[model samples]
Target: MKRKYIVGLHILFWTLLITNNVINSIAATRAHNTVIDSAVIFKDIMLVAGYNSIMILCFYGSYFLVSPALFLRKNYLKALLMTAVLLFLMTGWRYLLEFWFFKPVLGFDNYKGNNVSVSYYVSNIFWYYFPKYFVYGLLYFSAENWIRNRNRQEALQREKLSTELAFLRSQINPHFLFNTINDIYSLTYQKSDEAPVALLKLSKILRYMLYEGARDKVPLHHEVEYLNDLVELQRIGSKGLANISFEIEGYVGGQEVAPLLFVAFVENAFKHGVLNDPDKPVCIQLKASNQQVEFSVSNSTVVSGTQKDQTSGIGLSNIKRRLELIYPGKHELIISEQERYSVYLKIQLGS
Candidate 1:
């Protein structure tokens, strides 16, 4: 916590304490139905202020010194000894001020009786002061400690989240690059005219991955453009044999989404699903609104068992983990694998 904030809390606590004491003293005087005397009220205020000053000294002595040095370090015997010493000094100081200073100067005494002994005075002071002031000091120390610990935990959680996100993003970039490179290699081996265009598209994709993809979020349309480039690159590599349909249904201009969030699903479709079937081509759709975003990808599955197992690989798992960490309960993901392998994701935007 900030120093100013801690100081403010202390000031507020003391202000409330002094106000309550003054009000209660005035209320007691009014209850007597006697004429309100300004001299008596002033004397009461002076006594309250004088005693409270001693309490403040005792409170901070424990707060900054005894509690941290002895109690916090688990030196129970030493802490008890130190506390007793503090109480003794505070009680003695108050006794002298009341007996020698206030009684003579203002003709006011907190305790009145010729029979009051030394032991009774010390015990009375201990019971009154120790229970209130010392406990308050300990409570204040405990609260500050709790706040410090909670702040530390939150900071650590943020760092862990950032590191995990970066690791997942690293996995995504290379996975897509590996698949794209394979497609380019196929075209280069055949000396296809589309190889140069594919290389240009690859450069654009790399630029996005290196720059935009590294960010926590990017404009929704920027992600859409990245997906478009991926689809076009796949089309060029397949020599018009790849049947893929990509569409957008709502306004994405004002929306911002986590970068590269939808790429895993698209890559999964192209990797494990049938790409050449015109009757059931890879279908990608994204719908957006002011409050939410919905994205879905579906493709015809292969007949082989190996391909079916490959459908649920690192890419899908990585994206699932990312969604859980980033959005948690704000996102819904559904994967259906009966006739067609499909992944649908919906994310709630804003607070």
Candidate 2:
């Protein structure tokens, strides 16, 4: 909680207390059906103010001094001893103010009889003012502590989320880089002219990854352009043998999405799915609207005699964790591996 908000709550609490006192005084005066004298009302208000000023001091003394110094440390004996001292001091202070100052200078006294004794005055102060204000001070302290702890917890949670997201992004960048580098290496080994073109495309993609990918979100069009460049780079490396279809529906320019959110699925498709078969080419589709974004990637499953790729699931697992952290309940992800390997993702964009 901010200091200003705490101060505001203090002001509100005192305002209500003073208002209640004033209202009760007025109600008592009305019950007697007497004409309200302005001087008497002023005197009553002044007395109420004087008494409440003592209460304010007592409240803060417990809140800022006694409670932290003793009560919070579980020094109950010393806390009780200190509280007893405080109660007597405050009672004596009010007694002097009412008797020596207000009664003499302002012509009024809270205690009206000549038979008043020290014991009665002390009892009145202890039962009426001390318990009420002291309890209020302790309660306020507890509430403030609770608010501070909750805010700290929330801040720590945000920091943890940021760190985890950064780690996931680190994995994503290297994974994509490794795959793209291998494709380029294949071109270089074959002595193809398209290797230079692929290198140039790779440079642009790297720029986007280093700059835009570091951001939490980017314009949807920018992400779409990145995907286009990546697909083109892969095509160049394939020497026109790879068959891939990329499609976009609805307006993509007006929205924003998490950067590199869909790259893992695309990379997984290209890595494990048939790329040369025209009848079963890699298919990637993205549809966007004001309220949601839908993305899917599907490819024909390759039939190889070799065992499943041990490293193939890394990108998919990284993306799944990222989605859980970033979207939580706001996104849905579905993966199917029957006739074709397919991944579908839907994200709700509304706040």
Candidate 3:
């Protein structure tokens, strides 16, 4: 997650390791109940710290460099060859440090005054401590490789999810503009007095639509105003023959909703519900509160050859999938048909 968190964990790991090493050093010094001077204790710690520094550096090389470049990159043959070379060199390095450097320069080796042969020291380095060092290096390498793979998988998942979401949201634009543009054309072709007004209304709606389409959410007043303008656009050139009504029961001052989320239902109402009905009004109601928003649309079902079937349109299914993806468990949708057709939607907008 956060860089600081990962750094903190590394710090904690190093702290615990240093603490354990210090405890073991202290236990060994006191094993024979021998009184030790501060000077001797400090020198003992210096020698132990030097060895610890070397091993930590070795482990990290395996963790950060070799694992990714070889082991994780699937160069198994190269990884094995490199590892063998490293171990051979480290064995020689350890023998020189303990027999030559520690005994002469630091005077910290256990057999410092003894006449032990060079082969004896080499045997302890290669046979006794080499396996432990090799195992520790492998542990570090495997742990880092696992973290790398996990992070890669998570990044890929997020990218895929966002790409699909963008495609789904883009589908809304064409489906919506197609119907609105048709309504505007009908007014202009009739040479109706409302043609210019409907065109102007369409322009305003498009201004909002073009800007807000890319956004994840839009404010309450913007959506409410768009819905109102949409109804008025459909009402153009109607001459009071087709009845239509829109109602709002609560304030839309601070609410927010996904862009173009409510339009498909409105468009479907006009298309398949009341387009040919002169006396029956397509009723739309929206109620918004601090925590929730609800919308219901009802109209007389059209039984004309020109009317599109509501159940057979692309708009309904697209919006249904959109709602499921965007709101999931936060929304409820209901559709009923017997005489009049109606669709109701309710959403919990968490504050």
Models ranked on lDDT: 1, 2, 3
With a 3 Å backbone cut-off (N, CA, C), the pairs that clash in candidate 1 are none
Model 1 residue runs over 4 Å out of place are: 1-193, 302-314
Best by lDDT: 1
Best prediction by TM-score: 1
Candidate 1's TM-score: 0.49
RMSD of each: 17.7, 18.1, 18.6
- Residue lDDT tens for model 3, 227-342: 89877766653444557889999878767887776776776777667655657789999999988999998889933323333443435665666676666568999877757788
In model 3, which runs have C-alpha deviations exceeding 4 angstroms?
1-193, 237-240, 276-279, 302-314
Question: What lDDT, from 0 to 1, does candidate 1 have?
Answer: 0.77
Model 3: lDDT of residue 80: 69
On a 0 to 100 scale, what is the lDDT of residue 68 in model 1?
A: 73
Instruction: Evaluate residue 331 in candidate 1 and report its C-alpha lDDT on the 0 to 100 scale.
Output: 99
Q: Write the per-residue lDDT of candidate 1 for residues 160-205, one digit (tens) a residue.
A: 5665445344533454466678878888899988778889888888
lDDT of 2 by residue, 1-351 (tens): 578997999899887988789768877877895777887677667777778878887898678766765644577787787787777788788878888878987798556756678888778877887688878888888887677667655754674566444534442345556666887898789997877888888888877877887776788899999898888876765657889999999988858787888886777777777889999999999999888899999999833312333454335665666677566567999887778888889998754
**Candidate numbers, best TM-score first, in rank order:** 1, 2, 3
